[model samples]
Target: MAAAARLAVAGHRVTVYERTRTYGGAVGRLERDGFAFDTGPGLLHLPAVYRDLFVKTGKEPLERCVGLTQVDPASRHVFADGTAVSLPNASRAGIVSALDTALGGGAGERWGAFLNRARDAWDRSRRPLLEEPLPADVRPFARDPYPALRTGLLRRPAVTLADVGRRELRDPRLAALLESHALAYGFDPATAPAAAAVLPYMEQTFGSWYVSGGIRALADAVYERCRARKVEFVFGTAVTGVLVEDGRAVGVELDDRETVEADHVVAGAPLPALYREQVLEWESTDEWPRHQQAVRTGRVTVCLALRGAREAGAVHRTVVHSTDREDELDSLARGRLSERPTVVVLRPDDERLRPDGDHESVTVTATVAAGGAWASGNLWGAAGGPAVEAFADRMVEAAAAAVPGLRERLLWRVVRTPADTFRETGVFQVPGPALAGAGGSLLPAANPAPPGGLYFAGGWSHPGGGLAHAGMSGALVAGLIVEGAGFRGSQ
Candidate 1:
């Protein structure tokens, strides 16, 4: 949708072909018996990205299209040892005080100092890593951008996120807190660079927000904005292949044996799917970069419908940390389910999500191996398939610490596994954080492929996954298409 809007606004005729009947690829809504749940992301961060899109495209701003509410006490953390802390949104002092009260004496001071270092990293890499198109020569960014502190001849300077946590935080709970930020996005802190510390820093500096309705409303607004800009959308239509001739993409061929020719193509579909199904016999080895084939992770979400109303002053988001971090990462690396997984519980107080004020809607999510052993058959209904259910049960049990009497809520539940995500989006694995390594393997494929006239967007492309990154991907592709290879970035 972002690509479509930008292209249309640039005075180019734009058309979007969607395989699903509805718009919003990953951000979707689930409605059952008057209960509404956001099937994808539950919270919104770095909303400035979408705000910029609306300002550039139309007369009205994003706020006019979708009602956004900042989630105060942004999120609560429940440690395995049963320590709970509610962190106020965008308030470093409040967070420090809260941590001190909940955990120990110096925990707050340690975290505050760490955030200062993280801020430096964010300032250094913000433009190059995010707003701008990746430079052709990525060797400059291959090294860590995070500023190192002199610790008086300590063993070795921290490099990865795990090292930073253990060396600086010096408390298990605080270390868990830092690592949880990476784990929530399916990145192993042990391998992810300390530069990734920008994740928590971004959230704390800016705030976390939610739509008045589910997050699907944000998608609805984006789709509506595209439509208003005269972008045409064809639903339930699948493109059979990219019509490539003489080493250039001429257009696309639809399933109905009809071909539409164009000067350029911007593909939002997964790159792997494009190669395997949409592009025929096009054996250009360099067309798809080797780093694009790196393994990606996935997510499993369980939605709960409760009969009771959400209590006032309740935490909108709660992260139940996993007891065993090593085992969790190992399980994901081996394509299996972790015995003890970190669970994120979301409880929105909005009335639109439930039948009435008397009812409540809750969502529990965990990162898992994409297309794990559970993907062979319909795990949702297979008689012998108790693994998924058992995992879901454990997630719920862990979440009980956040939501009181969770099991006794006595309501029906719906589970969406990684297999379900693959079926819906055709992307077998959910894109994880770009690893920090020598050859820029940490980043996604560049916006422009080899040669001319072919571009890529969405999570599979540059800047990687998550709601904000996906939007940036679209903007990057549009910039490349509109301004040609000479384009630098949005700036």
Candidate 2:
């Protein structure tokens, strides 16, 4: 929608073909018995990407379009050892103070020092990795940019996020705190690049935000913006193939065998292999943004509609770290269910989401493996049997640490697993923000595919997943389409 709006504003007639009846690919809401829950991301970060989009494409800005507010304490984290800390939103001093009070020692200072090094990385690769196009030669980005502290007898650098936390922070609890950020996005911190430090740095620096009605409201606003730009949306339609002629994409073939001819074709990564094969070719060499066979991760969401009102001082978001990180990760890699998985609990203090003052809505989420053994009926046997419910039980048990009297609240709960996700969307909707290490394996395909006039956008392409990165991809695709291949990103 962002790309379509921008293109429409530039006098290009735009049409969006949506396979589903509604828009907002993954950002959705579940409403049951007057209680509503955000099925996707509970919060927004680095909202400036959307702000920039609204400013460039329409008269009404993002703030005016959606009720955007910064969360006070960005998040509360509960570690395995029964330690809880609330990090204030975008306030470095407040975070340091809270961490020092909770963890004692110089944990706060150590974390601060780490953020300083992370800032160096954010400054160095902010453009090429995000604001600009992915170059054909990814060698520059393949090098990790994180300035990890020199350690060991030979002064070797930290290779991964896990190494960074253990070698630099030097505290198990603090290490868990650092790694939790990566785990939230379904990335294994042990193998994730140390350059992933930018994730926390971006959140803490820009602060976390919430849309009044849910994250879905942001999508609604974007869709409305696209509509206002005179962009036509063809819903309940699927493009079965892209028509590539003379080494250029000139149109798309619909599921009904009908073809819509166009001057350009913009594709998203989540589209089936048909669109992928037609848009870009697979090459092992220096051709950038090649398709990768990833062992993607998926999420399990449990929504609890309670009968009682929310507590007065309940935090909006809380993360309960896994008890056994290694075992949990091992199970995830092996495509087995983790007994005690890390769970994220969200209790939004919004009245509209509940039945009334006497009712509350809570959502618990956990990241699990996707499309391996899971595809072989391990996650849930066809119709969602006991295995899926048991996994939700584990998540609820973990979330109880955040929400007081969670079980006592006594309300019905709905469990949505990766099986449900695959059944509905036919994909896991996983992977996270693009990073600068791991041989550029984390980065998605670039905006402009090998076939001229064909572009890629959304979470699956350049800059990877998340709302901000997805919006950035749309902007990059728009820039490439409007200003031609030489176009750099937003100034």
Candidate 3:
């Protein structure tokens, strides 16, 4: 929608071909028995990306299209030792104080010092790594941009995020907190570069936000804005292949054998899907970027609809850390379910999500391996297999720490596996955070394909995943389309 809106405002006749009958690819809403749930991305961060898109596309800004509220005390974390801390939104001092009160006296100081270093990483990488296009010579960014700290008697400096947590934070709980930031995005902290610290820094500095109804509301607003800008949308029409002529994409061929001709094609489909559908073919396997070939993770979310009213003072988001971080990461890396996986529980106080003030809507999510047994079609339905049900039960149990009387809430639940996600969005492999080493092995494929006039957008392309990054991808694609290859970035 962002790309379409921008192209339309640029005086180009834009037409969006959507396979599903929805505007948002993964961003969707599930309504059942008068309760609403956001199926993807419960929280929004780095909202300025969208704000800039709205301002550049039209006279009305993003605030006019959708209602956004900053989530205060951004999230509460519950460790395995039963220690809990509620972090304030965008307040370094408040977070330090909260950690001090909850964990110990020096715990907050350690975390504060870590954040200070993380701020340096964010400052160094924000523009080159995010706002602008991936440079042809990415070796500068392939090297870790995080600043190193001096420690007495330590010959070797800490390079990985896990190393920083163990050496600097010292406390197991603090280490878990640092690792959770990477884990939440489906990155293995042990292997993740020290630059991964930017994840927590970005969240803590910019703060987390939620649309009034749900994230789907933001998607709806983007869709409506595109419509207002006169962008044509063809829903329920699947693109089968890209029309290539003279080694360049001229248009797309749909499932119905209808060819939609265009000068350029902006493909939001997953790269794997494009290859599978024969839309894109390389001369050799080596042509594909190594980073784009990295393993991708998926999510398993369970939505609960309760009959009773939400308790007062309930935190909007709570992360229950795993008992064994190493085991969890190892299991995820091996494409297996973790025995004690980290779970994120969300309970929005908004009345729009429930039938009335008496009802409560909660969503519990855990990261899982993509395209495994868990992603099988049979496990997507309400009556999942025994193993799937057992995993859901475990996730619910973990989330019980946030919601009192969770099992007794007396309402049914909906389980959405990676298969369902793949069916809806066409991207079975959930993109993870771009890593900071191995010659750009962490990043996604470049936006511009080898074939001229063929461009890629969304999480599967450059700049990597997350709602904010996806939005930025749309902006980048638009810039490339309007200004050609010389396009630097959004002005």
Candidate 4:
């Protein structure tokens, strides 16, 4: 959306072709007969990133377009013994006090110390790593790595996420609570990079948030802003191929066989599809193997919408630990779902999603597996299939156990596995795009092409995933397009 807005503003005649029936690639809402569901990403953090985009587009202020409400005690962590720990985001001192009261003295201190390290890491990389583009050459990282390490950016660079957690926060329970956030990156924490610790720290520091009506509001706002800028949206259109002439992107060929010409093209879809399908013509001499082998992809997310008139009381997000924390690492590494799954229920403050007296809103989730269980049609509802119903029953059982009266709230439900997600969002293993690779962080390599009119955007590009970041990436792509869009006829 940002890229389109920028291109439109620069008078480049931008046309956005979204394969999905509606816009907002993976972070939009679905409304079906009075039931509203968040089809993709539920949590909204980093509001500033979005505000910046709105500002660039000269749209109404972000607050006016999207209601920004922060989630205090971002999520409630429930234990089998009925003990609950809620991590508050308002202030670290309050969080420390609560943890100290709930657990003990050192638990709070240990958490504080860990966050202090996170603060240091955030400061160091705030500009150099997170905000700036990383050089393509790995020498800086290969050399002294401490500049990145001392701040607790990413430890044990070559080791898996589990190794880092085991070494730092040894308590298995603490580790599970800490590592549980790894699903955000679509990897098991055990296998993910240790530096991933930053995710939780950031979330805890800057509470989770929601837009006023729904997250869909964010997408709608972007779309409206784009329209104001005269950006044309070719909805329900699929770009099947990139029309490359002389080894550069010139336009796109839709599935309908119509070619849309432009000075350059930017895609928000995955890169692998772009490359493997030859969307961008590759020079015979370019090194491309590392991109193919190392840029990994994430797994599926199953979303459920249940009919309910009652809320889950106080528990919003629950990570059920089947056993002591130590066992979680072993269990996850073995490719088994945790005995107690991590469930996040968004019973919002707004009364509308839930009829005034009834509770509503949806549960968006990510579940891991050993192999192809999710891929099997039996797990998701297929034609005349009982698998989806059975799976829904199991999820309801878990929810009922965690929150009283959850079963009685039964309504219509929809389940989306990774396979389903690929079909609905069209974000699966696309070519050319890879997850961020430089040091396991989202740092961009030098432009694959130098000083050309070409540009890139979307989660498939650098700073992959997340709706806000994806929007920001689009904005970045638009800026690049502005700089090189034949203004001076360099192309």
Among all windows of ten consecutive residues in candidate 2, which has the lowest summed lDDT?
Answer: 271-280
Cα lDDT tens digits, model 2, 254-296, are 8799999999999864633433344334453354344333536
Q: lDDT tens string, model 4, 1-491?
A: 87788677777887889877888776656666555666666668778777887776785788888778877667766554556687776578877777777766667776666677656645544443333333456345322121122224553333444554555555555556666666555555655544555666777887788777678777888889889888888888888877777767778899899998888777666554455555555564254322222323333333444565544355445554433444444544554444444544555555545445554655635353423212333233254245444544555555554455665665656765545555654434212222232354433332233324455566655444566557556655665566643222110
TM-scores, all candidates, are: 0.94, 0.95, 0.95, 0.82
**Candidate number that wins on TM-score, 2 or 4:** 2
lDDT of 3 by residue, 1-491 (tens): 87888989999999999988878988888999999999999999999988998998888888988889999879999999999999999899999999999998999999999999998888888876677778777777678878767555855767788888888889999999999888778777777788889999999999999889999999988988899899999999999888889999999899999998998899887777776556677666566553355555678899999888898888999999998787788876776778888999999999899999888999999987665322343444446567787888889989999999988984999988887777886655677645566456788877888688988888778788889998888888889989988889854
Per-residue CA lDDT of model 1 for 1-491, tens digit only, reads: 99889889999999898888999988988889778999888888889989989998999899999999899989999887878888999999999999999998999999999999999888888887787787888888778877655454765777888888888888989988898888777676777788878889989899999988989999999999999999999999988877878888889888898899988888887766676563534576455553335455677889999888788788999999988878887876776778899999999988889999888899999887664322443433365258888999989988898888888884889988866777777665677544444245567778887546888788778877778888888888888888887887876
Better of 1 and 2 by TM-score: 2
Question: After TM-score superposition, what is the CA distance of residue 167 in candidate 1 from its true location, in Å?
Answer: 1.4
lDDT of every predicted structure (CA atoms): 0.82, 0.83, 0.84, 0.56
Rank order (by lDDT, best first): 3, 2, 1, 4
Off by over 4 Å in 3: 150-154, 289-291, 371-384
* TM-score of structure candidate 3: 0.95
- Write down the RMSD of all candidates, one decimal each: 2.5, 2.3, 2.3, 5.2
Model 1 is weakest, by summed lDDT over 10 consecutive residues, at 372-381
Span of 10 residues, lowest total lDDT, candidate 4: 142-151
Alpha-carbon runs more than 4 Å astray in model 4: 80-82, 138-160, 276-308, 311-318, 321-339, 369-394, 427-452, 484-491
